[model samples]
Target: MSEPVKVAGLTVRPGEKARSVLTIPNFWADGQSLEIPFMVLHGKKLGKTLYVQVAQHGSEIMGLDALRRLINELDPGKMSGTLIYCLPNPLAFREKSRATMFDPKPGGMNRIWPGDPEGSLTERMAHKIWTELVSHADEVVDLHTASRYCPVWVFYEADGVSEKAPSETARRSEEMARLFGAPVLYVETEAYGGRRTLRASCVDNGVPAIVPELGGHAHFDEEAVNIAYRGVKNIMKDLGIINGDAELPKRQVKLKWRADPKVYVSHCDKGGVFIPTVSLGDTVKEGDEVGFIYSPRSFETLEKVKSPQTGYVFTIRENPVVHPGERLVSVPEIIEWLEN
Candidate 1:
């Protein structure tokens, strides 16, 4: 059953749609506080609660556009459950940086989840979100994009270590994944960057979640936005929150392994200007040449990079400037098409 939820000092009743700002006091230590913009669409009928988060990483701007379109597209009057969305970490978003402005580190605010109430800016922000919004979620969809390096794909956290089989979390996450309808789907077992992420936390908290990686990171791609909107809309339909059939694509590929393939990431051995012969969504043989590294001054070939595995070139390092040991490519062995 759906009940009224209190957020940002306002009680949002069922069958109501309200937009409120969750304010943080002394955000900048100059009597200036941060206000996170949020919207709640409480359906008249009872159903599952779906939490949609946008711009958590600041630089992932496609999610912001997707959410905006959702606000205009979905009709709460005919909906069954609640759709709560928020634009968190305004400081990082305003600066157009990946991480929080409080720190100059990588991974951004997403590194910290279920945040510390008495920690840094990101921590405090995360803490409030966890306590106020996230904990009450039944299902979640976090919008993010891969760095210029990783290509667009849908990712879900699954239990890699469980000896018995795929756990309930994995099943729910995978179900959500199939419903999302992306070109390529990556079932990120625990070994992949699943720790300390919001997705991991939600799963640990008994809330199944999925993160859809849009095309790029910096700017808003209308195409990417359209894809995201469809994903979110399909999830809503799947969860019975909205009354509609999920629109499915012609074909979808699942990045899989016969026995959970160990992903081999290729890093630059020598720092130089790198040129890639392959692009995203390309299939390659194990011994095929992928790209080359060149010296900036002479423009001479410094290194020739070849595929280590017969797989799909899912990720390609976009930036030419590379440092030794920096990741340049990620190739995952494509098992087969997900025949549903």
Candidate 2:
């Protein structure tokens, strides 16, 4: 049997499940102290540890329901590894905002990893989580939600194919991302470019990590919730932490984009009411008309938004009203298509 696992002042023995909260000190005398609540499941047999976190941004709340379902279904007595689930930004989650007033900057939870104890409030919370929760992870998954019209996808950092041999960590991360079973997978080749994101920090520390971006921010996307729940189980199976085969889609789009993938976003050139003709997951070629901007006042077509590359549509604006420079649709540069 495996030994007991200790984290965040809670000790979870083999074949046991437990919950605890790590309290963060409020330096300001009148400020309320922050707390990060987490759950742990320590299995009977010795195996790897998987750490999953959600709601770094309060508005990105689709995964919470998914995680809730996952927790209810998991059984520590029948498993062979450890599972740690945590809410990284409780303050933001409480207010249903992207970032709280105590944070140093907007969306600071996702930006700061391996945080400093003596830093800002957000940084201090991150520090506690990293040292007390994430440091014990053998693999990591950070869940997030995007725009309402965005399609579900997985993102992991990888070096260019020609740059050098891929590290073991990168290879494992790629495998995990594939097993996640998302319809779209993004292999970012440029790395984080100085961003201290949780996923990047874990990868840098020699632990494999991936981020799954569920769709429909601030709302319950039923399909996304189901996908998130299934994806986590799929990864657990792939890691030999569970007993089952990963269920993947019939066809999946794998985009190995170099540098910044956002460069492929089709932005509205004229301020008007934008209408997107292409739906998410639609494949498109360069110069193909995907959307149009109609002047609401003049009742005339201001511009026809054409796709910038031959790829799949993963993000489309749901709001019809638009302004100059607002994104209409994003068709990232495609590298390969996988079929199972």
Tell me, by TM-score, which candidate is best.
2
Best candidate (score: lDDT)? 2
In order, candidate lDDTs are 0.77, 0.84
* lDDT per residue (tens digit) for residues 118-212 in model 1: 89888888888888888668988988876755555787866653333337877888888878877778877544443567887777766888888
Could you give me the TM-score of model 1 versus the true structure? 0.88
Q: For residues 177-250, what per-residue lDDT tens digits would candidate 2 score against the true structure?
A: 88888888898877453557888888777888889989755478888888899999998888777789999889
Off-target runs (Cα >4 Å) in candidate 1 are: 1-4, 103-105, 148-150, 161-166, 192-194, 256-263, 268-272, 294-302, 321-326
**In model 1, which residue pairs have backbone atoms overlapping below 3 Å?**
99-108
Cα deviation at 293, candidate 2, in Å, is: 1.5
Specify the poorest-scoring 10-residue window by lDDT in model 2: 157-166
User: Residue 16 of model 2: what lDDT?
Assistant: 91
